[model samples]
Target chain A: MIRVVLLGAGNVAQHLYTALCNQTSVEVIQCYNRKGSKLHPDQKKELVTNTLTELVDADIYILAISDDAIEEVSSNLPFTNRLVVHTSGSVPMDTIHSSNRKGVFYPLQTFSKDKTVDFSTIPFCLEAENEKDYNLLKELGVTLSQKLYKISSQQRNALHVSAVFVNNFTNHLFSIGNDICSDNDIPFEILHPLIRETADKIATMNPDNAQTGPAIRNDHKTINRHIKFLSDTTQKELYQTLTKAIQSKYGKKL
Target chain B: MIRVVLLGAGNVAQHLYTALCNQTSVEVIQCYNRKGSKLHPDQKKELVTNTLTELVDADIYILAISDDAIEEVSSNLPFTNRLVVHTSGSVPMDTIHSSNRKGVFYPLQTFSKDKTVDFSTIPFCLEAENEKDYNLLKELGVTLSQKLYKISSQQRNALHVSAVFVNNFTNHLFSIGNDICSDNDIPFEILHPLIRETADKIATMNPDNAQTGPAIRNDHKTINRHIKFLSDTTQKELYQTLTKAIQSKYGKKL
Candidate 1:
């Protein structure tokens, strides 16, 4: 059996905790948080603790914590030569204390406490200082997701930045769309199918080939009308900038 | 049976043709195109013609053509006083000739000829000058989609602009993510699940509440790192612009 101890108590930590508990071959020896109330719980009192020094013996120490706290927390762990990993995409793996074997078990997904994610399809990006630790990380990741890869800290940093562009920035654009709909007394539900299909199209084709709309076509009349329709100066500037970006990418002179 | 004539042979025209042909109560009497090579065939050769003058008598004429071609095609129709409608989101209703009743039958979905759309869930926005014409447009729209709304020209323009942001801009963001992944030697599929979930989250919650990531949290370090990582000047500018936009929207003084 793989004895595991999960550190931190936020979204990623809680999710990893639940996933680990579900597997018969793994045991979460304990979970620690800086504050007693912050630790995620499902009445699993035997496996919860608040003090950092109270962490018990385990084969793996998974630090699914914030970016800022990773270095400090890993240094404070009162153990040596154990497999210590963090679930961060951008942070380098060497940030873990030199006394322990440093590794990363980054799940390439966004986690929310209330929303249950199906780990089977998520890609687990793993990294380690040595072969044995890498294999161990891979073994645990294989149980959680079917897809696994050995990503370097540099590659993972690129992935994280790309994620911000797709996930975070895309959500912002959607909010802008929602604002336009609500301001015009139109129901936002009307756009759901379109949005879902837009995401699905890329699964089958390259996003460049899947792209459609006025900007790509460079229909100046429609483009100008849309820009004039938007009342907010920021939105107007964004519309102009993104339109120019798309037009340039697609080789449209406009 | 509602006898209808369709004009144009592009993506929207082909989809509408296939949809109308499936209904038991609707008969697409004829479809017109300027070029004979563009027609999609199913042995219904007699109903399609390339000539503008060789049109048949029908209860309604549906001009499912480009926005620029709508006014010209609707004006050249041989029949007079028939209910004529153009399937355009941005085009005004009066673009139709004065000899016929004017209306709009806009299906608010991005259509691809290869992708079969589920018409029942697609939103059809209808508009007309009077009660009788509006009912005629609604009757046809109900046959195509369960979700139907009576939208004016002004409102339709707003919805069109909003669609640009959600569909076009969102797709562009996905492409950028794919580029980053391929550049880093990581498979682009890693970000698919995250993309799907972000879109799904907005279905249940407001996009404002659904927003996450460094910009929303005002984490300047990560944001700065991401901007510096992007080598292209245009993409870097976009990252800064969008990040500032998100920060300002969430009331963070960036």
Candidate 2:
């Protein structure tokens, strides 16, 4: 069994800790965080320490800290020869100390403290410097998740950007839709099924091919009508910009 | 059973036809299209007519034609004081001849020919001139769907705009994500779980509350890195516009 020491008490840390506890092949023996930040109440049974020097002996030290905190915490960690890894998508794995067997164990899925993730379905993106360390990390990932991908730092960076588009940008669009519905006195629940269906369709179909809109059809009358219907200036500008972009992509006149 | 005549053989027509056929209370006695358009081979057994004058007798007539074609077709249909309706979110119900009981039987969901929609779950937006016809249309909607909403033409127009945001705009963002993945030589499927989760989260949480990203956090370092990583001018502009929008909304600076 792999003994794991978790660092930080943030969303990712809590999620990783819970998922580790659920895994039969891995044990979270200890957890460390900055001073005054307590461990999860349920994890009090484990050796939780605020001081880096008090961290328990473990095969792997997993830093689930923020991007800016990686270097600072890695510099202060007690062990130099042990395997050190960080769970970050955008930050490079080597951002941790090179003295240790540096690796990354980034879970590509988003995590919230309140939302329990099904780790079996989550994709673990693994990276390491040496073959042995890489294999160890892969085995750990495979134990926690059904899907494991070996992605380079550069590729992880691209995936992070793409995640922003699909997750962040798409959420903003849903916000816009909710706003439009409220402004018109229509219940936002009416659009929920449609929103779910939109995401479901793209699972099997490419977004470019699944696109359906007045902009794609070049229906200027409908487009102009929608633009006029939008009450907020921000929404109007967004509609205009997106409509133009779609038109240009499809080789249609705006 | 309510005998119905469908006027058009397009995407909306095909979806509505299949949905009606699944219901025990509705019978599509005939389907009418323009002179040369090809009909569905499966629908060959049903009476198909090219001219409106040869329309079959039915209690309800549903015109599932385009917005522009609504007026032309409505002018040609021989109204027998029956309940006449058009399935368009944008077009007003009065666009059909006023000689009959006018109504709108718009299914507020995007329809693609190959995609089979769960009509029982789809929200049917109903509008009619009088109480009797409105109730009749609502009952017909209930026969095919469990969700029914009494929406005016004006409200339906707003919902259409909202649909564009959640459906059209969201799909474009997905396309952008796919493009970024392709350019970076990373498989686009990596972002699928995150995309699905984002949409799923908003179904339970409000979009504004669910928003998370570099823009929301005002992390200029990551934002700048992503901007520099993008290769195309159009994508760079899109990134800038969206980031600026997010920042403006949250009163965060980047």
Candidate 3:
């Protein structure tokens, strides 16, 4: 069985620990953090530690820390020439100390520590310096997730920014929707079904095929009315800007 | 049984017709349009007509036409003092000619002509000048959907604008995400699970509570990197604008 020392006790680390525990073919040697209290309560007490020197020997060390902490954390690891990977989408694998075999095991989905993720549906973006390291990561990935992408560091960076658009910006729009509803004394629950369907439509069709709105239609009358209807200055500007951007995209096509 | 004479053969009109067909308590006496060719093929030919003059008697008439055409079509209904409603969120109920009773039977969800909607989940924003007409529309809504809101013309207008933010603007952000993925040679499908989960999260939590990203966290380092990483000028502008908007929202709170 392959053994792993999971570093950090954040969202990615905790989620990976949960999924890894389900794989009979793999074992978690230990979970390391600056403090043991950060580790989930369900984590085996013996397998959780705050001291970096206390890390057990393992086939691989996965650093699931924040981007800024990655280089220093990898440099602090006492082991060398063993497989070491960080679960970051934007950071280069070379950030790990060159003394160790470097790889990336970025999960291409947003994680909230409180929310349970179905690993089978998430795409694991993997990169490694050697064939053996790649295979090891691939083996682990296959056990945890159905989708595996052999992405370069450059590709992973691009995917990260794209994710910000779909997840981050989309959530902001939903927030603005909530703001608008609450401003007018309407409950936010009324918008839930539409939001769910919007995401579902993109599954069966590309977003380009699925796009529809006054902006795309160049329906100036409706567009102006909406702009006037928006009371918040930021929301108004946002409405105008996105509407123009959408118009430009489809206007070129039409 | 209460009868609805559905006006127009557009996406909303056709979907409502299909839904109304399933309700044993409601009947669609006729579907009025300038051209019957747009009518769904499964609709009985007897129930479809191209002439406005050939309209049949019904308890209510729903003008499921375009926003620009709502006023004109409602004015030319060829009948007087009958309950006439237009299925538009943005249009005011007063747009209907004064000769007939006016009401709004708007289903607050995006409908594509080809894709079917689960009527039971869609919110029917019902509005009328009087309680008698409101109850009649409410009776129709009760037969079709579980979500029925007694919204005023003013509240309905506010809901329409809110729907634009949640559905129209949210979809555009998704399209931008797809564009970013395509530009960087990443398949848009990689982001689907994240997109689905983002929407799913808000069903149980408020959007503000669910929001997470660089701008919300004020991570200017990552934000600048993403803006520089984006090559398209328009996409870059959108990124900066939305990032600033998100920052302003949380920056105030922070």
Candidate 4:
């Protein structure tokens, strides 16, 4: 069995604690949080540690902490030469400090509070300093998910940026749609089906070919109408900018 | 059974034809395409009419045509004072010629070619000149889908603009994400689960509370790193603009 000492008590940490507990071949030996108050309440009191020195010996030390705290925490770890990994997409594997066998166990999925994510489909992007560590991470990852990518720091960084675009920014666009609906006294639920379909299309089709609407079609009449319809200055500017971006994407000249 | 003459041969028209054909209480008596070559091949040759004058008498003449053509087609219709509607999100109902009882039967969802949409969940926004025409349109709408809203021409116009943001603009963002993945030699599919979950989250939660990432978190370090990582000038500019927009949205200072 692979034993793990989970670090941090944030969303990712709580989720990791639950997922690891369910794995027949894995045991979350301990969960460490700087503030003991933040640790999962369901975890056994004995298995919760407030100080780094009290962390039990484990096969993997999973640092499910914030990006800024990664360096300090890894450097402060009581043990060295063990596989230490962080669940960060942007932070590099090397950020875990040279005192330990640094690696990354980034789950490329958004972890929202109170939401139960399907770990089976969440792609776990793994990186390590050696073959044994890599295989060990993979073995642990496989217990939680089917997708495990051996990504480097550089590639994972790119993926994180891409993710920000697709997930974070896309949600922002949905917010804009919500705002537009509210301003016009329309229900936001009206756009739910369209939102779902937009995401569904990309699963099978190339987005380039899947793209539709006035911006891609260069329907200036409709585009101008939409621009005039939007009352907010920022939203109008965003509309124009994204319209231009889409037009340019499809090779349409200004 | 309600008899209908369907006009135009675009994505919307084709999808409507298939959907209406499946409804036991509706009969799409004729499919008219100004250019005969655009007509659906599966439609019976007898039911396909290129010339508007050859359009047979029906309870409703559905113009699922381009926005620009809605005016001319409705004006030249061989009949008068009948329920004539165009399935366009942007086009106002009155744009249809006064010679016919004007209405709008806008299905507020992106209709892609060969993508069999689940008509049950698609919101059909209906508007007409009179209560009788409105009821007739709703009858037809309900035959195909459960969602039917008596939205005004103005409200429908607003919904159309909002659809552009949520559906069209959101798809472009997906395209951007795909490009980033391609540039980094990362398979775009790696981002699919994240994309699905992002859309899924908003179905249950408000987009405002659903928003997450470096920009919303005001993590300038990761945001700056992402901007630097993007090689394309336009992509970088888009990244900066969207980042600023998100910060501004959540009341964060510049």
Winning model by DockQ: 4
Kindly list the per-residue Cα lDDT of model 2 for residues B142-219, writing each as its tens digit: 988888999998999899999999999899989989988888788777788888898889878989889899999989
Better of 2 and 4 by TM-score: 4
**CAPRI-style docking class of model 1 based on DockQ:** high
What does the lDDT read for residue B124 in candidate 2?
86
Fnat values, one per model, are 0.79, 0.77, 0.80, 0.83
* Order by TM-score, highest first: 3, 4, 1, 2
* Structure candidate 3, residue pairs in collision: none
Candidate 2 residue runs with Cα over 4 Å from true position: A36-39, A252-254, B35-46, B252-254
TM-score of chain B of each: 0.95, 0.93, 0.95, 0.94
**What tens digits encode model 1's per-residue C-alpha lDDT throughout B114-200?**
888789989898899899989877888888888999899988888899889999999998988898899999898888888988888
In model 1, what are the clashing residue pairs, if there are any?
A: none
Assess candidate 1 and give its lDDT. 0.87
Please write out the lDDT profile of model 4 over residues A151-170, one tens digit for every residue.
89999998998998899989
Give the Cα-based TM-score of candidate 3 against the true structure.
0.97
The DockQ ranking, best first, is 4, 1, 3, 2
Q: What DockQ does model 3 achieve?
A: 0.83
Instruction: Provide TM-scores for the models.
Output: 0.96, 0.95, 0.97, 0.97
Write model 1 residue lDDT over A93-188, tens digit each, in one string: 988888899999999888877988788888899999999989888888887888998899999999999899889999999999999999999888
Separately for all candidates shown, the number of backbone clashes (residues 3 or more apart, or on different chains) is: 0, 0, 0, 0
